[model samples]
Every structure is written in structure tokens, then in C-alpha cells.
Target: QREFTQKKTFTSWINSILAKHTPPYVVSDLYTDIQQGHLLLDLLEVLSGQHLPREKGFNTFQCRSNIENALTFLKSRSLKLINIHVADIIEGKPSIVLGLIWTIIFHFHIEELARTLACTYNQPSLDCSSAVDSSPKASRSAKKSARIKERWKMSATKALLLWAKEQCSLHGSVNVTDFKSSWRSGLAFLAIIQTLRPGLVDLEKAKARSNKENLKEAFRIAELELNIPRLLEPEDVDIVNPDEKSIMTYVAQFLQYSKNLPESEEDLQEKVREAMGWLAAQEKKLAKLLVETENETYYQKCKEMMSFMETFNQEKTPFLPVLSSKRGEAELSEGQQQMREEWDKVVSQINEWKAKLDQMLPSPLDSIEAWLQEVERLQAEDLPDLQDPFKAMSVFREIIVIFKGLMDCFDSHLDTLQSFKNEDEKNMPLVLPEKLEEMKRRLFSNIRSTNPSTFLEYHYGLCSAIANEVKLKLNICDVKYGAKESVESLLENW
Candidate 1:
């Protein structure tokens, strides 16, 4: 599902939760609960920190591949969270950033379309062609060809990197720079985006040549892969700003975050650019450290960490996780049906649970007790079904834990706390005349059996049951959370 996880945020938390579970359409319902602003924030995290296991072990350079293949059969459907968020943004539907970037992409494609049409015809139309032409300049037969040309020009690869750089630049800091999934994919992406390498035109060819077993793969091969003819290479090309400064030196330095080589002047510039993009603008004064190279230095330590990440991605040794199955499929069949049978059993259990839900709790009071019993029964009926069933149990058990707290003890003395409370509950003290007590005892004797303690426990549990209901009412599960380190000054008071 997700190769990397930063559970502190809502989307990542959802992704993290989903990563540990199975089956589709489970948490998809919670989508409405997540706020629009928070989704954008999590999407930003993916643009920044989502990682992969491209690196094999301890090493200097590390790589992690982006989820270039398969959207169908992931073991966990965590990626769905990303897909939904990104798709929404692309549709010009995101409520935040005013859909500014989505609008940008839209206008961007208009420009790309004109460029492609000119490229395809080998020249501009003799007549001015409006973006949408009433009179077809090209025959209907050639529409398919025009569409392909347009498709080639719209690179997910290029868009993603420029998107990264823009986002980093927008954030004004490169303090958190885990762009793309892995260095391999990131480098390949950069090669196409900035270097104007066209080999990525055919995603299929790129995929075939970039496999783990393909030893012929290289950082620059993207230029030749799709086109089948080597037309460009960053190694041979020189990048420079309008000011006549070589840009390769800058890119080389940026790449050196995971390298130990001496910093090139251009390299230092790139480093500064990326650092400035990712780090907060407030830290601009400290930006010079990116050029430092000596050991025991802060910049050196930063470089080593990048190196470790890069090395990890490149090491896909035998011990590291391998994908022997075909790419793009979430699950690779091992030619074994045993695992399949177990998975089916769990699905059946969940299905049966849905079917018997009403029967399981015939009475409202019974629902609370029945829920706890049902989960235990479900677990006992098939142990494997509950094995890492994070989706079903987390919120479920949180209710159980709250219920247990309500039952263990009641802070009856609380002007604010009580085992039981209602908005309509009066603050007046309990008062009853002896005549009323005698009548109440007589009424209780006639009623035969209702234990207040047990009733109170049941009532408390019932209130706890509605906790999920409250979370639902408030649209809470989608709230984003982050780790915080209390300042030493703040902790001094503690």
C-alpha cells in the first residue's frame, strides 16, 4: 500500500491504518469526515515525505522507488487515500489553494496542446487554430494521433518534480526533502523534467527497462528508453541560468546531499536552491551550511543521512523485500491457495457480521454488550481474520476502552464528572420522603429485577457506544495530528 508512513497526520494515519489491514472500500466511507484543508496538508506530506524500501540495507547511497506500477492489488489500500486526495485536486475540485495549481495545470495543458499540434503537423496551421476549432484542421482519422501527441507532452513524471520544486519553493524550506518515493525514481523524474529527456514518452518501455533485475538501468537511461534513440544526456549537457552560470554544478551539489564529494560551485547553488525551497523562509540566514562538507559538521551529517537513504534504495539485496510477481498488481500469486482461503474466510466473517448485526443486538441496551461479544466471537471464530485487522478494531476498541473506564469507577463527586449525565440532568441533590422510599421499595419489589449497578454499567457502556456516534456527528476521525516535542522551557514547569 504505502511504502512510507508518517502517522502523525490524518491522511498518513488513515494510510498507516489502512496499510496494516486488507480489503477494499473499508475506510472509504470516512472520506467525508476528513476536512478539505486537512486533505491538502496530507497531500503535501506525500509530495514531501512518502518513502519506499528501495534501499536494501546499511550503505552510503539509498533509493526507494515511487509506486510506478500497479494500482489494483496492494495488500493494504493505503494508497487510496492519496489517490482520492490527488484526484480531487486534479479535478479543479479541491476547496483550498483555491484550486490554484489545478487551474495552472489546466491552462498549462492548453499551451501544451498548441505546441503538440504544431509538432505533429511539422508546422503551424496555415490558418490560426483556436484551442477548440469549429472547423477540423486535421481529418477525424488523425484525431487519435493528435491525442497521442498531446498525451506524450503531459508527463506525470515532469509535472510531479516541477510540482515538488514549486511546493518546496512555496514552503520556503527543504528541511523535509523526501521527494518522490525513492532516489531512483526521483532522479529518473528529474532527468525528464529538467533535462528535456524524451525517453520517458513511453511509460511501458521505461517500466520494462527499469526493473530490479535490469542491470542496464542508469540514471540517464530515461533519455533513451522511450525513444529507442539516445538524443540527450545530462552528463553531456550543461545547465546554466540566464546569468551564464553552469547549473549542473548546482544539481550535482543538490544530489550530493546523499553524496560525500566536494561541493561544486554550481552544486552549492542547487543545494542552496533546494534548501531554500524546503526550509522555512525564516531560516534563510542558516542556508550557507548546505555547502559545508567536513565530517562532524552539521551539513556533513545531513549529507550522510541522505547518503544512507540513497544507499538503502540501491541495495535491493536478497534479504530485502522482493517483488517476484508482475508489476502493478498489489498481490503476486505464490501459486498457493492456502493464503487465499484464509483471506476468504475473513471476508466471509465480515460479511456474516453485516448480515447478523441486527439479530446480534435485538434490543438497544443489548447492542453495547453484543458489540463487544460479537468482536470476541468474530476473533475466536477465526483467529486469522483478526490478525492485524487494524481497521475494524482501532475505533472499535477505543470505544471498549472508554466503556471500561466508565464502568471501573464513576467520579460521582465531580461538579463536572459523573458516570452518567444528561443535558437535562438537574443539579439539585437527591431527596425523597420516607413515604416515597416505602413506595419506591414496594414498586421495585413489584417490578422484580433491575439492578442499578448493572443498569448503570450498561447505561455507561451505552453512552460509550454513542461515542462513535459523537465522533461521526463532529466529523472528527479526519482530524490531523502531529508529534510535538515540548520545549525544555515548557517542561521546566512540569
Candidate 2:
């Protein structure tokens, strides 16, 4: 039953993405449709907007090759595919095909859903920008917890659960504790539709209906009115236990499509007010993170703010009104024009903040140069005095440790730069080979062993040699003094 639900839901999901292609392709049966693998490639292309190379022939080898190419692409995305293989998919194995599709859905849709949902959290303002209680304790507590509150992080599952519970709260007995049994009755679905459109779902009628009847009605209304893809069938969800993942995948579309729903004038006005409030809050948050400091905390906050800006750009930008239309007419209301100007300013601020962060965050080359400067300082500094061997040894050890620490920092920074390249090449820092070579040459010229240990050993040897010379000189002076004393005593006796 679970597999049946998954097959239906995943097939609809793929078909929905594929329908957006230039020439729509519908998959009647996911297992057979994806057996040849070209459709699978098309599905991936639509979902990811990436062109995947595929074998065009219908022969067994070509088919297998196409499947292999798709699998390779999935693996390159760092997706964990357990026991999934091209042969299994090629043979039209239902379980393998279902598993592959689920993996795709989890990665492309579920993971992105998690990230998108993060933007919706009403995090406390970074400062006391909003009204606060007049009590001293209240103000102090709010200030004390502001930093922690600003770092808003919530799991996708919990976020979705909260959203569902909120949507169904007014309906009868439609408790959505988890994605599984909570939705098995299908009242939750009706309640969501009813909340979105007041008269769309007759909640009273739905409650009196059988589970299958209610599920079917909800799916029909959603597909017809909302244009949401009917990912699950009545039987798929009306069973004793519906598939949790399938329900989640289906429910998420409601949130995705909610924005496109036609709003009344009142609702649109409310949206504008809400958007303005949200922008004000975000601006306050940005201001807090925009502190003038070179500390590690400041750097981390910059990183977090940059990430938040990315989400804002993707999700919130659509709601921001434009002052002028593409036809060069001022189409927005006065309030909207103000909103647009504010939005533009916020966008400009984001760009400026991002540039500041990029410059402040040490690039790989910058880290290397900084590391070389430190090592050079160590090289030029005078070696510790051999008179106190213990202190000298301690100083040498400290310098060596610093060298090792710098190298470790450089490696970590380089890895971070490489990751930035992988994630987005445009954001990657430029690395020039000539400059790197020059730094490398300067570093090695000052020491041998090609390691920090070489610096340690050289200083250690120098300190030992100087200590031995000092000891020898002291012994010789003692001998000479004793001889002089003996001669003086003999002259007195004569």
C-alpha cells in the first residue's frame, strides 16, 4: 500500500515537472516510463535546469548507458543511493524505481522546502526595534536573548507540521500530530482548502463522509481550483496507514502554490502591509549584523546574514512591488512606491553587505600571504639566548607551534574556498599561480625539511651548540683562575 501511494505521488510529481518542458511529456507508469532513462533525464533537466547528456538509441546498451548517466549525475549531487543500480531500474524493478524517484523528491523538493521554510520563521528582531515591555527585567531578558533568537533554525518537518496544524486548527477533530495517521482521515486536507478558500470545502459535509470520500473530494478540489497536481489517490491515503513521505510531498505543494492564489483587494492590501512590516524587521536584523568589527563573531554573523539574504532574494523578492512598470509607467500606489523604494534600498544594502563580507572573509591567496608574513617574522626574529636553555627551548617550541597552526589554518581556508567554487563558481576567489609560486619560494627559502619541523630543528640545534660553547668557556675560565690562585700562594710562601 505504501509503495502504491509512493508510485502515484512520485509519478505525478515527475509529470508536473515534465509538463513544464517545451513539449510536455506525461508518465502513465513511472517504472516503464523511466526504464529507457531519457524521460528520467528530461525530468531531471526540468527539476534542476541542467542539461544532462544521454544515449539516444533504443537498444539494451543505450538504455543502460542512459540510466547510468542519470545515476552518475545523482551521485555527483552527493545523494546517498543505497542498493540502487542501473540494472534494477532497467529491468523495471518497482522498488528500485520508486526508491530512485523518492530520493530525487527528497533532494530536489524536500531539502529545498526545508530551506525555503526557514525564511518564514518570525525570528525576534536583532535589536529592540519593535516595542518592548517597560519592565527592566523584561527588557534585560529580551536583550540578553536577542543574539540567540536571531539565529533562527528549524527543521523542515517541524516547520511543516506547525503549518499544517495552524491551517487545520479551526476544523473539527483534524489534529495533525505527524504526517502519517494525522492525515489518514483526510480531514486535514479539507481543512487546509477550507482555510485558503472559505467556501471551497464544506467541512461539515466532509466530516460526515467516509475517509475515502473525503480524501477524493479534497484532492479533486485542490487539483481543480488550486491547480495543484493530484499526487495521491483516495485509496492511497484512505488506507489504515498512509505513506508519511508521500503525504509530506503532496502537502508541500499547497504551500508552494499558495502564493499564486488570487487575492482580493483587502487581502492584497494586507499583504502589502505585512510585506512592509517584514522588510522593516529584516532591515533591523541587517543593521545589527552590520557591526564594525574584525572579530570572529562578526565574521560568523556576516556569513549568516549573507545566507539569510540569499533566502530573502529567492522567496521574498517576488512580493516587493516595483515603482515603475516595464512599459515606463508609474503603476504603483503611493504606499507601493514607497515600498518599492524601500525594497530597492534594502537590495542595495544587501549587495553592499555582501561585498563587504567577501572582502573581509580572507581569500585563499590572502590567507597564504598572511601566513607567509607570520613565518617571515619568525625567521627574522633573533633566536632565544642559550644562557637559559629551558626558556630558549620553550620559545622555539612556541614558534614551531605557530607555524604549524598557520599551516593548518591555511589548509582549512583553502578547503572553504574550494567548496565555494564547487557550490557557486562565481563566488570563488581568484587564485593566481605566479603569486602562489612566489610565496611558496619565499617560504621554502627561509627553512629546510620543507616543513615547520625544519625551523624547529634548526633553532634547536643552534641553541644546543651555543649552550655547549658557553659551558666549555665557563670550565676553561675556572681552570685558569685556579692556576693563577696557586701561583700567587707559592710567591707569598717564598
Tell me the whole-model lDDT of each prediction, alpha carbons only: 0.28, 0.62
lDDT of 1 at 435: 18
TM-scores, in order shown? 0.15, 0.48
- For candidate 2, the per-residue lDDT at 46 reads 88
Q: Write the per-residue lDDT of candidate 1 for residues 316-434, one digit (tens) a residue.
A: 12111111100122222332122223322432332332233223322231233333333223221211112233433454455456545543322221212122221223553221122
**What's the C-alpha lDDT at position 468 in model 1?**
56
Candidate 1 ranges with C-alpha deviation above 4 Å: 1-227, 233-237, 241-311, 317-331, 334-494
- Total clashing residue pairs per candidate? 28, 0
Across residues 1-494, which tens digit of lDDT does each residue of candidate 2 receive? 77777888888898888889978999998888788998889888888899999888989999998999999999998777899998899888999998898888877876566555444333321211001111122112212221112112225555565556545643433545467766767798987787666578776677688988888999999999988889888878776567988998998887676545554656656666777777787787677767533454433555566456545543443342221111111434555555655655665576556445434434554555555556545543434444555666677777777767766665454454345331225654243332344344444433321323346555766678677877876666454535767867854663
- How many clashing pairs in candidate 1? 28
Maximum-lDDT candidate: 2
